[model samples]
Target: MVRKPVVSGMFYEDNADKLSSQIEDSFHSEFGPGKLPSKKRTREIFGVISPHAGYQFSGPGAAWAYREIAESRPADTYVMLGISHSGFPSCTSLEDWETPLGTVKVDKAFQAAFMERSGLKQDETAHSQEHSIEVQLPFLQFVNKEYKDQLKIAPIIISEEQRCKEIALSIAETIKQTGKKAVIIASSDFTHYGMNYGFFPFQDNVRENMHNLDKGAIEHIKSLDADKFMGYIDDTGATICGRLPVAAAISACRILGAKKAKMLQYYTSGDITHDYSSAVGYGSLVIE
Candidate 1:
């Protein structure tokens, strides 16, 4: 079964040519407060945390992470851990995903291996309308344009935060024993602030407070402290959409021997819309 694109026209361009052009533009665009990082050859880039908002808002940040992945060329398979916005079950899907660019084959072999080890169910309902993982496909397609057929995906929706460590261990063990080189991607956006998300912890210095809140979570992620990441989220009630997924990726990356994580870019929708009244944060990071 092929999982059709649900947010194509809404979150990104639906036309093939337009979508490709938009992605290429995003790659060429400057990110953060400076020029994007120059591409450098690196070894063993195991994981990345990428935002899943619209291409116009989060695309530059996403490009920074994808550019790093393109430079490293870590693996043939990408394990995508996405938050379930549709409130679906926590599971993995073994169905090809359709995007404006083309269809990305599902790595059934890897999915089976992971499910066997983790005891997670295989369900497509969880992925039916989820946009988090879907939005990242175009970037991967553009980055791997030369080897599009060589790329495969294992998409997993994370619903249970408490099971993250166990799931990560199982995934790590499966990859190690199978000798399959893979990269993990956590799809998340940070701190939905203002009355929109009802997460108003501060009335003054809203932008500064949001940055500090998100930075605290990023610090735990950079440290590869999964427990601390989760604890920080729970204690602060941070409105990070993919805290569980990020924690799982951190745990898996730690098990895969990844030491340091580098923040590629950080910004919010407010930066784009010039409306800080209601904002959502986005960040890009790579674990090595």
Candidate 2:
């Protein structure tokens, strides 16, 4: 089974040539890394935190994470984590994911193991409307030459925030049992501000306050402290779209021996749209 691209031509380009060019431009964009990913991969990456928004608004920020990923030693599987409708529970899919770049197979071996170990169910429909996971695939396709055609993912759409630590333990154990070198990718956007989002924590000095707000969450994430991260979210009502998945990622990374995380990039839609009134904050970080 194949899950076709859902956000193409909107969140990103529908045409392959143009989409590829758009990604290239994002790498060189003023908000982006200002250069392409390196040809060589010598570093090791345990996991990453990426924002899942339209390319124009969050692509540059995402490029920072992908640039580091592109240069890291490849993983046998990328465990993609996303958030679905509330109360959906954590779920995985066996269907291959299709994007403009092409289709990437789901690592069924890991999928089965993750389910078996975590007791998470397999449900394809849960991912149909979620862009959080789909948005990261093209970036994966764009950066690596070695795994271009052979890329594999273990796609999961999580909904239960309370069971994140338990689910993460299962994932970490599954990776160890299967001997699959893997990278956990948690897709999320931070701080959905403005009246549109119904979240106005601060009225004045948004540019400064927004950074202060998200940086607090980033500090917790960088320390790989899922408790503090989620606690911060609860305390502040940060409006982070995929907070649970990010918590899972941080938990799993910690279990997998991730020492620390480093912030790769940070920007707000206010910075892009020039409308601080209603904006979302995007932050990218790598756990190593």
Predictions: Cα RMSD each: 1.8, 1.0
Model 1, position 58: C-alpha lDDT score: 87
The stretch of ten residues in a row with the least summed lDDT in candidate 1 is 32-41
Report the lDDT of model 1 for residue 120.
93
Please list the residue runs of candidate 1 whose C-alpha ends up more than 4 Å from where it truly belongs after superposition.
30-42
Q: Against the correct fold, how does model 2 do in TM-score?
A: 0.98
lDDT of 1 by residue, 1-288 (tens): 799999999899999999987877777766632333345546569989999999988888888888877787647789999989878767999999999999999989999998999989988888888999999999888777777888899898888877888888987888797788899999999999999898888888877888899999999989999898889998999999998889989899899999978888888888778788999999899998
RMSD of 1: 1.8
Task: For model 2, give the RMSD to the true fold.
Answer: 1.0
Which portions of model 2 show Cα errors greater than 4 Å? Answer: 85-87
lDDT of 2: 0.90
Best by TM-score: 2
Model 1 alpha-carbon miss at residue 262, Å: 1.1
